[model samples]
Target: MKKLYYVVIGLFAFAFIAYLFIKKEPLPTYNVDRYYIEGKENEILAKFLLAKDSSVIELDEGHFLLGQSLILDGVNNVTIRGKGIHKTVLSFKGQNKGAEGIRISNAQNITLENLTVEDAKGDNIKVMDTKGIIIRNVQSSWVGKVSEKNGAYAFYPVLCENVTIDGCISIGASDAGIYVGQSQEVTISNNTVFYNVAGIESENSTNVKIFGNEVYENTGGILVFDLPGLTRYGKNIEVFNNKIYNNNIKNYAPEGSIVGQTPSGTGALVLATENVHFHDNVFTNNKTTSIALSSYLLIYEMGKRDAEEEKSPDELGNGVASADKLNDEFLKDKKYNPYNRKIKIGVNSYSNSRWFPTLNNDFGKLLLFKKPFQTIDILWDGVVSPNTDYTICIDNTKDINFYNADLLNDFKNATTNESLYKCR
Candidate 1:
């Protein structure tokens, strides 16, 4: 009787397992939606039009003049899907004036999916003044960067808003891999942008977010800049969860030129902007600082001499702002360049080092530059303080050349406060 009960329980368990197995769905061998289209189609393999001369547009493979700039205009409520990237093609054989693979303007509810745009003398995809824009599984590559020499063209969007960019790949761009300028409420996420002068750039826009993007190996990765007097102020930008690495690119362009190479040498930079958030981003292995924070420094650096008080306040907050001019009469009042600016690394007591003395190999802190800087000050004592002896006096009676000057100048201009008290 006990053995019969045990067999009954085992059979019930087996029957339940078999029922669950029969109810399960098979795992898909493949998802056709994820497949990339390939190969050529009939005709010259030019542009494919959607809903020719209708409010609703649907595309098939054929040589068609696409977008509003071409045969048709006002593409409203359009669903433009490709048969496959291989089946359809955009022939920009003689697109001399700002030709794009798809030039969308003044449209609504626009959807572009599963397309490959190549040989765009300009931008592969250009959207303007559109609402509800969606670009999925899109790949775009330009012939090269177009400047005055090659005609001003790029895979770019200018003066559009409420944009969403995802799962996109852009390469070999002249200006930027992904360029979003003067747009509002935009999101550029999960995109691989590479091999361009500027990786991903947002200029003079607001309420924008850049999240989870791989921006690498560009001349400069992710620049947020406001051109002087452009009338566009970059505000409320958030850059987070992005890997920005190796963003230094050489600029042989002549000084005082903006077009050739984008300025602000940084892996990521925030310049003269406000309400910007930089969080959880990996910035490493760059020529300049991983991130540069600079604002209102220019007003102090280059304010006019006459309006010094108006521009820069004195220590007492009085009108005597020309202490800078007074310094010229007393001592050279020139600002020290970054090379001579005493680079320090790490915190004090824990880890800190002075650059002129030696490679300290630590982060900078307040304790590093508290004393009157002297070469012997760094040599005898690691740092200078009131009680410490001026060690430079023991080494050389004439001068301790501090700032890497030429030997001729060093001998003529050697300074000793004690011996040369009357020289001043």
Candidate 2:
């Protein structure tokens, strides 16, 4: 008994020592004020917010009414957080000079969390030319009903890399509620979006994973597009495990906007993109085509834009070819392929919905004229690549019907051949 007692005591001592060795250190605390009233004396909030590296800027639990925008430029290793999403609100309803409510540019290692921004002239929160960005628990919107006068995008991140947008809410965006463009290595998850033209959009971006998002009551639930005028093309995207429903909002985007072309009640649209996979999503009551596979044929110069349009090397080129070289020697123009490729649609649940898509636009008119007999579940453009051994694959969605508009052939005919796309 004495020997066993000693052994037990030794074991407890060893465990305590191990716990001490493996325990995490306590996080550092700062002595700064939560209200951050440092630069309010001059009424210049931008001066107080010019954060340095390794800085934590916290907004107190209060409403900040600003006439001008808040700009965070060229900052690194900084965190801008609020007391809570509902507790801290930034209203730019009176903004007349600035284009956005909060604009962060040329930033790295930046974090924005627990804040609400609303009613700016342009995007509510725009992050550009950034790397290592994290946005969480943010709400952005317009105060009134959705209209073209509202900002284009609610939570907009373009020309960024390594971005993560989670636990966000958006409403009343004229264009996209959450728009990520010309970005790479992005993950957009756990968000709720409504009352927007396109609820969630990924344009000219690559290596994106959009999952666990709830999108409803928007003009279009989700869109993956590769529009012209961008240097990069979209590819390698995965959308899964999302709730897309009731996206029958009328399209109210301003004329000439890319989203203005999106017809009302569209559940999801994949246009002029590549290597996209959709799986395990719930679709119901969308009131339009549940899922559409299309090309830029209608948008990109009536589908006749040269696939090899060249671009000059500006300062912000894609870094494929060096910009320092003289004009003629290193001017290797990258070929732009606008055709959709390697699309896999699988295992998605669809209901008795989207049978009567709203006839609100020219596309809707054309669709109605071509195939007025029945509503479609999945609408493919019927634009095939020249080197195709069935670039599109569909699996596990046997209950739903399919339609091939053959849009490129002047919308002359349609077909419902499940064998044509069963390459998966």
Candidate 3:
């Protein structure tokens, strides 16, 4: 019995020592507010040589090919600092390109400053479920292209709050240049975003402020959207004092867009967002529509839409309602995304002020003249085929049946019609 007791006691002692080594991290300790992380060589990911603590991790300048992965996990109160912005790169471009440029998950009170990243197959910078994060004076250039699965956006914050992005530059991203989703109290200011689908976009985010951004030359700039099927809603957006112009470029708009060439992440589209305000921005020289807002926010564009064009001159209401009706039929149970390929243009879309010249060419002639642009296609069930004459039935009541002259005439019929509804 005495010998057995000693054996058990010895085993317990060994296990306790093992726990201390495995669980305890190196450097700066847990939750230490101050520390520096440096890369030992340009050819290796020296900054990620060991498990990092919650302190500030400083990376050295020049190209770094990480032999392994650097994970800054649930560590809170951290800062990832490096040399000049766009100076240091983490290139997993070789055989093993990992998940993100700097994948930050579930950490709060973090600051990423004075750094540049490239060649990350996934999101260049991804922050998830984090709060009170700040990204200042940072640049991420040439994040992956759109052809591959992960080669997408430069910065994407999913499920975060109290975020601020200031004085940052992002270029050549497959998705929106800088994006945020499902967050509150967010601010994106003084950033230069270009060569992306949509410059700066937010979805299902509330109390958001996007100001002082030089968002230009992309397909579209500064888009705030909540279409359908997204698990959330977006409202209370304030856009002011920025140069939002020349976003209407030629060719099809990039991905995540809704208008130009099937509404890629094209310029400044707002949907179903309420209590929004846009003022003092220079919107000009864009190839496509300047600002495509919900029918409710049509007042926001003021004089941009010709008074005669808002309502169709046809027998029914404006064409958008027909487009909506057709959209419900085509997409079926899928939440209607105006950016989707079909049903993008309003019925009699050729006459709306937002209509483009090419729309009146071949495809436009077919749609407007009923000429059959190719095979007329429709959606019945979850399949795509040609169905010309089926009546659209909405399983979900969200669809609007406002066809032809319905929206504009009904909206202002009190003045346009004769009899008791005459304008004063």
RMSD after CA superposition, every candidate:
23.6, 20.8, 24.7
How many clashes does the backbone of model 1 have?
Answer: 11
Best by lDDT: 2
Candidate 2 stretches greater than 4 Å from native: 1-48, 301-334, 353-355, 362-374, 411-413
TM-score of 3: 0.59
Pairwise lDDT winner, candidates 1 and 2: 2
Query: How do these models rank on TM-score, best leading?
Result: 2, 3, 1
Q: Model 1 over residues 183-242: C-alpha lDDT tens digits? A: 777788888766555677776677889888887666567766543433345667778888
TM-score of each: 0.53, 0.80, 0.59
Cα lDDT of all candidates, in order?
0.46, 0.76, 0.52
Worst 10 residues of 1 by lDDT: 342-351
Candidate 2 has an lDDT of 0.76
lDDT of 3: 0.52
Judge candidate 3 at residue 5 and give its lDDT.
Answer: 100
lDDT of 3 by residue, 1-424 (tens): 9999999999999688546423322211011121223454332344443425567677777655543335566767888887867466555444264667677777888898987766566667888889888998887656333222323567778788899999998765545678888788899999998766568887768788988999876655877765444455566777777776555332223221232222322346565454455555655544334444443222212212322445332322122122232233434635333221111211110112222211312222323233121211111111111332211212212221121112233333212111121112
